[model samples]
Target: MKTNLVANCHKAITNYIHHTPVLSSSLINDIVGAELFFKCENFQRAGSYKIRGATNAILNLSEEQKSKGVVTHSSGNFAQALSLAAKSIGIRAYIVMPTSAPQVKMEAVKQYEGDIILCEPTLEAREKTAQDIVDKTGATFIHPSNNTNVIIGQGTAAFELLNKHANLDAIFCPVGGGGLIAGTCLAVNSHQNGCLVYGAEPFEADDAYRSLISGKIETNDTTNTIADGLKTQLGDKNFPIIKEHVSSIIRVTEEDIIEAMQLVWERMKIIIEPSSAVTVAATIKSKLLVKGKKVGIVISGGNVDLAKLPF
Candidate 1:
């Protein structure tokens, strides 16, 4: 995976990905008790780091394949990403989203002029609908998390992080479908073996944590997390890489997420959704106890609906 990923798609995903800066913050660093280097991927185009994977997946396709168009199932961000990329390339895109996905995200897909299909919130239903669309249209399916190309493209985030700060002691990212963390672990393990990789999840959606501990895939019963973007089961492609390189999993509460969101908005002046805030939440509440570590955290996305906030 490393050889195939690093050697091949890294260059392909460059300019399209923001390479969002890693800034040192006294507020975050002081509160967390570490030199907190925040990789502000919240600044990524398409409101997330997903643009890299979407671009990579599209570019890897043959002209005939692209001519046939692309389709995928996503909770939201990937849908918006692929929609934007597909529009840019003059290719058709179909995005199947769960009915429960954030309305704002669905609107973004529509704004990109994507054909949106709503499915029941279950993974099986979403995938089935996506496959049906693919079969009906001859469009290639781009798995949101499981594909080698997508994972490698995601790895570029951690790759950019390390390129900026080589001597970091650890990297933290919120986990969901595991594309971001799995790719991040691969990049960090190959480039910074000394740095620990941590996956942060809301307690309500802590499937990755349980899955890692039990040495098998696990699902959470309480899928009622506000972190809507971190709401998918782990995929086969992401599982082995996680089991291999992930240092540990940390769980944060809903309160922690809210506080973290407030922290970014008040101190960092950044608007992050609940899912992206999980990295900040776990960093401050769960893993901040790791004193003296130089920790780098990827703020995955910043596409929050601020008008809904009571603030």
Candidate 2:
């Protein structure tokens, strides 16, 4: 919730990121029973807000630091973002991703010209493989959420959202590793807009919710939910930021997530991943409420493989 971090992130990532659009849908507002604004990061470059964080992390690097290239581990979106960003700046990118990452994401990373290292589908394995890659290649390790620059960079979304919709009373974002919510907390609550920032997590893997209630960071004993994108444990850095500035974490289920994904695709005409659908699901499931007040929900990514989607 540092003001300086938000300011620095704004300054650092301004040239690199999009001021992703915020649109109000009477259709969504009617369905959700709230006056709603959608911060459509699903429409963002790299298909996600991950680009904001990834680009910030890469562009902040010193010439000497970037000389060895950059390495990161992701379920999908971050890998694609880093791949695209690194390629743009003429830096090499090595991405360690779970084998279970959506085929679409894996293909996108390869399409963006990243060197992909596949590991078993778990954060632990992904981290280990990423470390091994870094050790051998001398590439700098860029954590998806734990990195400060990355967190700050991710906050730029809220900065843009608030600039566009200053009156929003609340904002809901999907929580994976907690980077997006952490940055949002800093940008929205810790700063001038003072919106109530809530995080949505899969009930199947509701680490952030438990961590918030328990007053400590918690990892799910076993990951679940179709939101394969939200499986990472909340970060140490992000936990503190959420505890400080975020209002609450809302939990939803795989059923809820799939329903939400279908809603977005069918009604909103956006192809959202289940992870991104968490926010919409939380809003609809009455796990959280916005009522007559203005509400903002971030669509985190749209990289779901339709062939893999559950109808």
Candidate 3:
């Protein structure tokens, strides 16, 4: 990917997306043994950083494609993002979601005027359903993590982060489909500074970690993690960038995920989902990876189900 892609994407989507604040906690800094900056995408529009990519992807669409509309399959954040993004541009968005997805997220998508198509709670079902929509409506298919435009858009979050804290030693982000982290890598790489990028993953859905080891995209044998958003596997498009730029993938346990989630809520007083907490958990679990170094952690989103609080 061109280095200028992230800069161009940031410019294109600046008005559409939030330049979310970078937060720091003395307590968290003490625990992690580093001056950590949390790029809080949890406070972003549609309640996640997914809005950045969704808005950019829609903006880059041809007028004919926009007129025909767009379609994608997402369990939560991207569904709400695409819905809101399309609505802002006065276009239709078809979101295929798993039947088992959080009700709160499903409702958020509806509130954004997205047409939700329910499918079996499986990746195959979601993809097939979304493809069916594209086939019938002649709508453009925007893969949540796998498309080039979407990846560039996702990088804008990190681009914004790096712009604020140009001297960061490293950055840790939760990896699911790898879009966010891949974009993050691009953003960090674009800088002349030698800032490293790391990915955090739940042990239950360690496909990205395993893929990095084997040098090929891998699938999860089980999707039993509390970090619902990190359950998706990396795609061919984002995986290559991740493998090339990410320093390493740290796998954290479910217990650690909850502990980190509770820590951020109790300390930072921020509402972050389990997926977002994975980055913090990984940092706490592997202090050796970034000891004494000033680092940045991307708080990916804040769309947790209130009724299902793990704490």
The lDDT of model 3 is 0.91
Each candidate structure's TM-score, on Cα atoms with residue i matched to residue i, is: 0.94, 0.93, 0.98
For lDDT, candidate 2 versus 3, the one ahead is: 3
**lDDT agreement with native, every candidate:** 0.85, 0.83, 0.91
In candidate 1, which residue ranges exceed 4 Å CA deviation? 1-4, 99-102, 286-289
lDDT of 2 by residue, 165-253 (tens): 88888888898898999989888854576579888998889988898889988888888678877887887878888888778778887
lDDT of 1 by residue, 1-311 (tens): 46457536768767566768887779777888888888887888888988888888999999999999999988678999999888877899999988897888888999988898899988689879988988899999998888877888888888888878998889898899888998898788778459889889999999999999899989878787888888787889999999998989889988888888888888887777788888888888754456888888998988877667734
Which candidate achieves the best lDDT against the true structure?
3
Ranking by TM-score: 3, 1, 2
Off by over 4 Å in 3: none
Model 2: lDDT to the true structure: 0.83
Clashes of each: 0, 0, 0
In terms of lDDT, the poorest run of 10 residues in model 2 is 284-293
User: Which clashing pairs does model 1 show?
Assistant: none
Q: Which pairs in model 3 have colliding backbones?
A: none
Rank the models by lDDT, top first.
Answer: 3, 1, 2
